[model samples]
Target chain A: MKEKIHIIKIGGSLIDDTELLDQFLDQFSGIKGKKILVHGGGKLATTLADKLGIEQKMVNGRRITDKDTLDIVSMVYAGSINKNIVAKLQQKKCKAIGFSGADANLIKAKKREHAEIDFGFVGDIEKKSINKKLISKLMKLELVPVFSAITHDKKGNLFNTNADTIASVIAQALSAKYDVELLYCFDKEGVLEDVDNPQSLIKTISEEEFSNLKNEGKLHKGILPKLENALSAVKNNVNKVFLIKETQLKNHIENHHEGTEIC
Target chain B: MKEKIHIIKIGGSLIDDTELLDQFLDQFSGIKGKKILVHGGGKLATTLADKLGIEQKMVNGRRITDKDTLDIVSMVYAGSINKNIVAKLQQKKCKAIGFSGADANLIKAKKREHAEIDFGFVGDIEKKSINKKLISKLMKLELVPVFSAITHDKKGNLFNTNADTIASVIAQALSAKYDVELLYCFDKEGVLEDVDNPQSLIKTISEEEFSNLKNEGKLHKGILPKLENALSAVKNNVNKVFLIKETQLKNHIENHHEGTEIC
Candidate 1:
């Protein structure tokens, strides 16, 4: 049996709140064993973009990354957010190193080539791109790796990528070497039966039950992608997956407390 | 005998031009043995700050890092500039990693304490703060380190620091294990005795001659601090320090070419 490694994706919304981030860091520090934290962009990037008069390109409500947008996102994601989180983790006694995928060629990506749309500098990560050897080396040194939503094509261009995708790709890639658990931690406690009711949390879901929830129109819209990411990890040989509450991270680590585990 | 390591500092002014930077990187990649590359900020940060309406804070003509300015600087230095350099180096086939000081607590700092000034986010790197073992490991793998001028206080505060100071400090710290050569490359080829005559270059300056030049007030005004930094590195036991032209990087590396070497 391989030693377990947790790849946790921290959602954008939880990062901007100082008090909550502090508490989250405090809890995250208690997680004993190897882990990695992947973080998404917060509202600050958009705000900076607006102030700079950079037009936001949205296609079907999804943001398109133009060259200018890529620069802003890189600044926000890899710069302030990544460094701040590393500092906070250090303060919490969790030694961590921040990385933009370009660093050490940790992730090599190909620019998104779509037939209809040009998503200027957005990249879809390539296969076998994760530097698992380097990562494993760092993990052995007991340093947590914190990654920003930035990647690079080895040819010489930076790309803005989705943090959750990066997390999932990394988990799947590492599954061969370690028993990996992919966790999507956000504000919600778990997958709720009723979207509005926190008390209507579902503790676990298998593929058969997940399809039933999808067919019945009972699954939360925001959680659809998260579940898909989790299911993909499971199918890819990751040992387990979870959709857990950020506030409950401490209990989840110490007590193996319940979250919406997907098998 | 200590192994040789070149800790080269690239001046900010040389970074913006693509053709020049590309050529410089190609030459840099040709360098043999262990190395590191530390870069300073360029006009992008100031331009971004101007666009964002963040006032530049200056104390007696020296830039002071207030919080808003620190945010912008981090975005420029650690974000686009750092990653862009990393990507370019990778394109040159020199595997490199970029860092802000907070990464892995590699360079812990303390917020500047002063009676006369409140440079909000400025930090002076603490002694014994360099992660020599981690850096040695990376060097052993032939991965060059590229550092941005941001250090954390370990208590969660990210700081804006002088890139030259960072280079000096790191060089001094690493001198015990390496015959370190600290290079500061800028636009000018070397220090010229007659400001208008390139042929009047001062190829070398000893400590005594340095004081004579200082007394004569013959050095260029802008180069004063750089020379001071080089002198301090020499004082701290760095094997050698050089101020050479970015375009002449290849010659300086392969031919034992002439530059303003401060001994």
Candidate 2:
């Protein structure tokens, strides 16, 4: 039997709230066994960009990561947010180390190619991109790696990668050596039948169901990418995958069914 | 005999110039054997702070790192500068990994305890503060560790640390396991007798000579802390210490005497 390792990803909303982040980390630190954290950039980057008067570049209504935006995201995600989370986890007695994908070449990415739109600095990654050997070695040393949504091409460029996809690919890569459980922690109570109703939770989501819901326009714009990433993880042989509430981490870890599991 | 390692420190001015920094990193990559790089925050932090209208807090001519300033430095130094350097080094085929003190609790620190002034997030570290064992393990993996001048209190706060002091203490800590040569690479041709003449470079300076130079008030203000840190490393068990020109890195490594040695 392989060792169990939980790969939990948190979105930006929780990180922007200091008190909530601390509480979440407190619970995260209490989890037993091996774990890795992946975090998204919060509103801080957008806020800083706005303050600096760096206009958001959009092509076909899709957000584009220009040089200035990439710089802002790199600083916010890989620097401020990543270090702060590591510090807080350290205080909770978790052996957390922070990283961008460029660190030790943990993850190498390629610039996203498009038909008509240039995504600027956006990167696309696959399971092969992850340096799983070194990651396992780090885990063997009992170190919890906290990763930021920043990746690099070996050709001297840092790109803005999606945090959800980062978590998924890492899980896919590491599943070869560990019993990897990937969790996507968000603001809601799993996939909701009604976005506002906590009681209307979907206990499990399959790829067909997800596609149907997405096609029916029942899913919100934000949860679309997350569910896609989650499905990708399940398809890639990740042991288990879930979409859970940020506040339900402890409960989910204990009862093993607090949120919607992806099958 | 212990295995050899070169611990090099670079200043902010070098980092501020992109072209010069790339050239220096190229030279750095050409060097043989185990090595580590510690870099200072360049003008970007101050530039960002100024743009954001965050006033520089000073007391008795010493800068204070308040909440706002700390946030900016953490973002610029640990995020933008460190990752960019790592990416560039990777491009040069150097296996570089970037870090802050908080990463893996690599260097735990204490808040600066001053009698009259509050330095806010400034942290002070010692020889014992370095996690040398883990660092050695990292070196064994053939990864070059690149550090940013950002540390944490372990109690949940990231602090602005002096990059020179960080290099000195790390060298001191690792000297027990490696034959360490600590180098401070900057713009000038080592310590100069006449600030304007590169030919006026002092070949070496002992403690007595350094004190005499200080008493004569001949040394410039900026080099004072750097010289002090270099001396401290020599006084500790660091095998050797030098202040060399940034451009002379390759020459110094080859010829082994291009800088002003500290005895």
Candidate 3:
């Protein structure tokens, strides 16, 4: 059987948790497979911007990346966040290469302009142009490719992309014979049915049910996009989509516990 | 008198020196002026890439930014390095806002394919479309702009730019009635008379002498580019250029330092 391809999306919240992040890294170091790690640094970016007195403006929870905001986001996401993960993985003896979308033209994208609201510096992946060959080369050498959601265009202009979405796209693109699993690892257990209750973890949710919950206002904003991204991955040929707590990796991988499993 | 505009380029080498970085931040915190900071992260970027077993190749000392390398560079320069500086400044009570080229469309550039060598993702300033208004607004709020040398195109694509060059460009652009002082801060005392001798700091050098030294092979690679950038700023109306040791900030500002003062 071909090596199992797992694309894990680690959110900024979980990445910032030193204890949890170290634990995840330890578990990841022992794992033997072709793995791709995509990460987000939203909290870090926003907090730094706020502390610097740079106004934080978001359109629908997503940062409205003007030139100034893009600068801050790039620094936080690609610089601090990416390196921290690489360093942690290295400490665990994992051969991991951290990168942004512009590297090797790994993920080419077009800046999405929606009506009057232009998502400045935001990129939608040029799915066909993604150089999966780069990932394949690295994976063959047993190296984990850690990616930040920053891409470039044909002309070599960079764009800030959504990490979860990028992971899904990458998983789909790299889908060969092995089952493609996308793990959206965040701080919480999984997609919670109640925002205030930690015990209200949804064990499983179908696409229809997820949409219904979203419409009914039961699904919170944080997990809604994650769910949509997970569904998109499933539709795009990923075998399974898992939303699990980052710290519960062993439980989820070995015992399959305490998270929403999406198909 | 209008607060003198100072453009300071803090290099990765100095940042690596913890003591120097801390000292510079403390000094910068007390400075009263409209200041813009441009930073380089070559050392950190290369270190991380090497640890990951990624063979780093450079064209003219600048990293040959392929897709993967660009990602690494973005992460190191914009993400990790940027935040560390901002955090340190914040710790010192300096209101510092970190930014990359994509923010506020502040710096726009065209990819230079000079002499058939495709300098992958490297950009030259567009000159016309720099978002001075956005910078002006930020300065009005007394927020010191810490810039990463990344640029965007008219179509919202990001590119890696030379921090020294970007600093020069920004200095010229932000110049009003007061002369813009461009200071390239690094670990070295200044441009040396002899590369082998640390004590041979050149106190002053004319444009012609600087060029002569380059031709004579006394100046090579990285420093050449930095000098070129400094000269470009001088030619473009920036008032002065100083190659000063980051640790000697107080002496340099007080006009008593042993640094290479270029005019």
Candidate 4:
């Protein structure tokens, strides 16, 4: 029997809020068994970018990362924010070791090659890129690995990557060794029938319903990628995937019944 | 017989230069057995601080780390510079993990309280604070641990620390399990007698000679702490300690005959 590993990913908004981050940390530290936490760059990165006077490269509402933006993200995401989380977790008595892709080549990525978009430093985490043995060793020592969404090419160029994609890929990679569950925690209760209503939580999202929602164009652009990532993880043998509200985190972890389950 | 661990400490000047850093990395990677690299922040931190208009707190010719200065140093030293070095080491096939003191509570520190000068966020690392087992586990996996001079108070405040002290403490802590040698790599070949002539390298310095140099005021302000750190490490049973030039790194590592040996 494979030991279970919980791979939880927290977005920027939750991390950026002090009270909520403390709540999340308390709840996360309570999780039993081997686990890993992946974190996104919060609004702090954008604020730093603004402070640095580095303009974003936008074409058709899509932001392309240039060298300057990459540096700012590296400093904010990999530096202060990441350290902040690690320190807080230590206070919570969780043995947490923070990581960037550049730190031990845990994840190596090549820059995205789309002729249409010059996303200078954005990298997609490659398949087989997760160093499973290193992670497993850390886990064996009862250490929880905390990761920032900053990866690098083996050639030493750091790249910004989507936190959700990083979570999904890591789930798929670790599924071979551990029974993995990937959780996407956010503000909404779950997949909502009425996007604006907090009470309209969809308990479970099936593949057919996901297809119908895609065809109906009811899924917002923001949720589309997350759903896609969740679906892909399920198909790739992840034991479970959950989209839950940040407030419902404790209940979901304790009850194991709330949140939208994707199958 | 105890296994050997090389704890090499590199100063700011060598890390600031691309060519010198590459040279150092190449030589350091060639070193066999369990090893760790402790690096100081280069000119980049000071440059970024100047650009952000964060003034240095200098009192009576002594630099104090105010809160703002601590944040900048943490960002530059632990974030970008540390990650950059880890990435390059990965390219060299050295599995390198970058760290700040907060990670895994590896080094717990107390804020410095001096009556004369208020060093705002400066921390003195506590005794027995080094997590030797965590480090030994990493070395057991053939991973090189690279550290920046940032430690936290466990209450979530990150403080600026000296890399030399970090190296000395880590070496002393690991000496029980491994024969440790602490190397302080900087600009000069060694401690120079003339201070102006590079060829006047003091190949070795004893406890008596060190006291003489100190009383004569021949020791510069910067090198004092490093030499003090080295002497303390020697007293604590570290097998060897050296102050060597960055350029002579390869020769020192391979031949084991260069650098200023302190006894």
Top model number, DockQ? 2
Residue lDDT tens for model 4, B1-263: 99988999998888889888998998888888889999999898898888778899898777899878887888888898898899888888888899999988888888888888888888897449798888898778788999999988888788888889999999999998888988999998899877788888999998889999999999887778989999989988899999999888779877896879999
In every candidate, what fraction of the native interface contacts is reproduced? 0.89, 0.88, 0.19, 0.72
Off by over 4 Å in 1: none
TM-score of each: 0.97, 0.99, 0.54, 0.97
Q: Output the lDDT of residue B50, model 1.
A: 92
Candidate 3 is scored at a TM of: 0.54
TM-score between candidate 4 and the true structure: 0.97
Q: Which pairs clash inside model 2? A: none
* Cα lDDT tens digits for candidate 3, B1-263: 55587789998787777787778887777767777778887577776567555786767765566766666676667776665576566556565666666544567678777785677877888445466766776576566888877665544245678888888888878765446888998877889978767798888878999979988898846688888888887877778888887877777777645489888
lDDT of 1 by residue, A30-103 (tens): 88899999999899998999999999998767679988999999999999899989999999899899999999
Q: Give iRMSD, candidate 2.
A: 0.5
The C-alpha stretches of model 3 lying farther than 4 A from their native spots are A58-62, B1-263
Candidate with the greatest TM-score versus the true structure? 2
Please give the ranking of all candidate structures by DockQ, highest first, separated by commas.
2, 1, 4, 3
lDDT of 4 at B219: 86
lDDT (Cα atoms) of all candidates against the true structure: 0.87, 0.95, 0.74, 0.88
Candidate 1 lDDT over B56-166, as tens digits, reads 888767678888998898888998899999999998899889999999888888888888778789988733878888888767767899999988888998998878888
Classified by CAPRI criteria, candidate 3 counts as: incorrect
Residues forming the 10-long window of minimal summed lDDT in candidate 3 chain B: B150-159
